[model samples]
Target: MVEAVSRNSFKAYDIRGKVPLELNSTVAYRLGRAYTELFQAKKVAVGRDVRHSSPELVKALTEGLLDGGCDVIDIGLCGTEQIYFATFHWQLDGGIMITASHNPQGYNGMKLVRANARPISGDSGLRELEERVVTSAFAEPVGAHRGNVQVCEVMPDYVQHLLSYVDIAAMRPLKVVVNAGNGCAGPVIDALERYLPFSFVKIHHEPDGEFPNGIPNPLLPENRDATAQAVRKHGADVGIAWDGDFDRCFLFDENGDFIEGYYLVGFLAQAFLGRFPGAKIVHDPRLTLNTIEITRQLGGVPVQSKTGHAFIKERMRLEDAIYGGEMSAHHYFRDFAYCDSGMIPWLLVLDIMSREGKTLSELVQERIDRYPCSGEINRRVSSPQVVLESVEKAYAPGGQIDRTDGISVEYANWRFNLRMSNTEPLIRLNVETRGDRKLLQRKTEELLVIIDGFA
Candidate 1:
């Protein structure tokens, strides 16, 4: 039986925690063994990010998988999506990505998937895996029948698949600012540069596990200046930034203004609806009016799923949605096994700009003015349930209340969604208004006051 292991890392979606304490070589090895036993995986693909602890953890994980008689295909030093690609692209039994995404340094995690690259989150198989790892549910290695390891290169084909999303010949010669934030996206940009016409002004481009330029999450307002300044300095037409694992990408306009991911949801929804009329577009509930209007205007259906990758992917498959997006910058495609891709969103945006003969700002300026939103604001609280109840009690009286994911209260001219973070101990609030920035600001402040009351 395995000794007691830290269960704090087993989150609702993936495994993430501080190095050695919550996650270490021992945990990774048992996880690999539990995963093989749970899914009966014979051949699995394993990929990892540039975290300092990744290589050591991956080494132990591989040994455990082999001990379980599961052959391992190592796709080294890759982003999370690469593991998904390697699994589906190679028809492997499953895939495991060693990454902590945007988490701070000295921390790491893993994203797991079964065949077809479908996520194995808490409800599906992760809970079982956790139980096994916690209680010692692994058998000894079959010495004679141990699995072998093979190193495979997935970058070339992955790049080709990304290029398939846009018409290369139609792309204009525009200067684009690409910021990898010292994560995994730099190599991807380099690989795609030769095939594109855009000149890239790269920033924090190399994969440095130490995070010399800070964590690659552009979602925070402070982390965005580097990408925005690069665009202004280089007179670039657009800017793009990706997180550590590159599953989510953020965009900036030619004016060096950071575009909210909420706007991009409606923008990309419109793009997909233009190509596939009457198709279903799945979106999260946090920010919805803009996406709903655009989807309906373009003769497409708007489906609202809970704000999460696992939930969104399931909804996409259930509705056969052509596309899915979150205000948090995760954009999913039907063609890419319903998996989210940070690379694909920017390429599609470039295609739209090239075809419409409009700048990035021009493309989204109207929507921005029409549906101004207070970008997602997070506040740490002691009791999230109490805070949520208080907000719902105060706001749900006259407004339309929807509890699909959280308490989303909508009035005729304004709307806001209040939900607790799934991974962290914080309450997240998103507020938007119909062409009224003043009302948006007022309501956001009002909500913050109520949220802060409990704290």
Candidate 2:
């Protein structure tokens, strides 16, 4: 007989659930056996974030790994990117990171990576692990080959790796502020500033599992004000913040205005293309026009990909894209094994601003004006598919429609992507126009009505 596993625990890219109930020692033990059997990995590196429940879960996971005849190197209390770093740096057969990644306090999850930092998702290897956990068919080890857990600190070397990507000597002296939101980013940012030519004002720079300033998610409007306020109050040239695990970063202009990730995509796209001319750049389908226009203007190929990191990274590797980005702030680099980094994007942005003698806002303003967007609006509904179907049915007769990731309806003047959230029961709508805010607003409203009508 198979042990029951909660279906809700299997998310789009990872296994995320509330602690103890959905993800506990039993689940970890089963996952360890499944991972070892699936990858045949003899050695694995593990890292965790600064969450209260993380230590206990890490112990449970390590025990399972040992039981499965694998050696585990526990790089204690690090970011998701650091786990990726450890996998490649230490030549481990696989790596796992215990992080909810900007989710609330009670939430905890795992990010698995194959050798060379290759991600393991549901379609790839995660589903197999899930099956093993559900079936409880893990084999017990017979011999005395139990895995040993060793503590290792890789932050210093990881910081050096980050600095290698940017020319710190050429970086002009500038005032910057970083809000880590009391997450794992504080230590990395602290080490990075020590080697840079800029002065930094750090806020919420301590690692507090309590999340005193709410969750570290910068996507929420409420979470951004503090970073913006710090930038303006300190007369800083730029402001940057990261989510809990620091996988995605948010930027603010000198005047404390939050810069949209779409514009940053163009900015970084132009920078990477300038270095590797004619290289392919991949972007999500949500903000196609901006990336398309920028990549064309910069003499590079712009390829549209479906949202989600798994899709973006796979597409990047397939197209040999030098870089990939989404409007939701996930940025992936081919140089980093097509992995998304919350640290690399800001470093490149700062380098661009420093080298060009352009303000952060000035660098991205033209692109923003060229492509005005409605951002992303979420609407709750019982049936997300029904809502998306309704929106598609409403617009399909009059416009060009594509269901690449979601339903994208396009006309000559404007376009919109109405897709259902993979993790939540909601429809995400993003509308953009050539240069008209009014048209964007109108279409956004119409799309909202179509979506709500289904409810």
Strongest candidate by TM-score: 1
Count clashes in each candidate, considering only residues at least 3 apart in sequence or on different chains. Answer: 0, 0
lDDT of 1 by residue, 331-416 (tens): 99999999999999999999999999999999999999999999899999999989999999888888999999879999999999
Q: Estimate, for each residue in 1-455, the C-alpha lDDT of model 2 and write its tens digit.
A: 66776656777799898887888767777788888888988999999998888888888888888888999988998899999888988889989998888877688889999998888997888887887778866666766878788888888878887887788888999999999999999989877877899899999999999988888998988889999999999999999999989999999999999998988888889889888999999998886888888899878999988888889989998999999999999999887878989999999989988999999988888878888999888888899977877777678998988888888888998998888888888888899999998898888888787777766
lDDT of 1 at 76: 94
In model 1, where is the ten-residue run with the lowest total lDDT? Answer: 133-142
Query: Which parts of model 2 are misplaced by more than 4 Å?
Result: 1-3
Which 10-residue window of candidate 2 scores lowest in summed lDDT? Answer: 1-10
Candidate 1: which stretches are off by over 4 Å?
Answer: none
Error of 2 at 95 (Å): 1.0
Candidate 2, 304: how far from true, in Å?
1.5
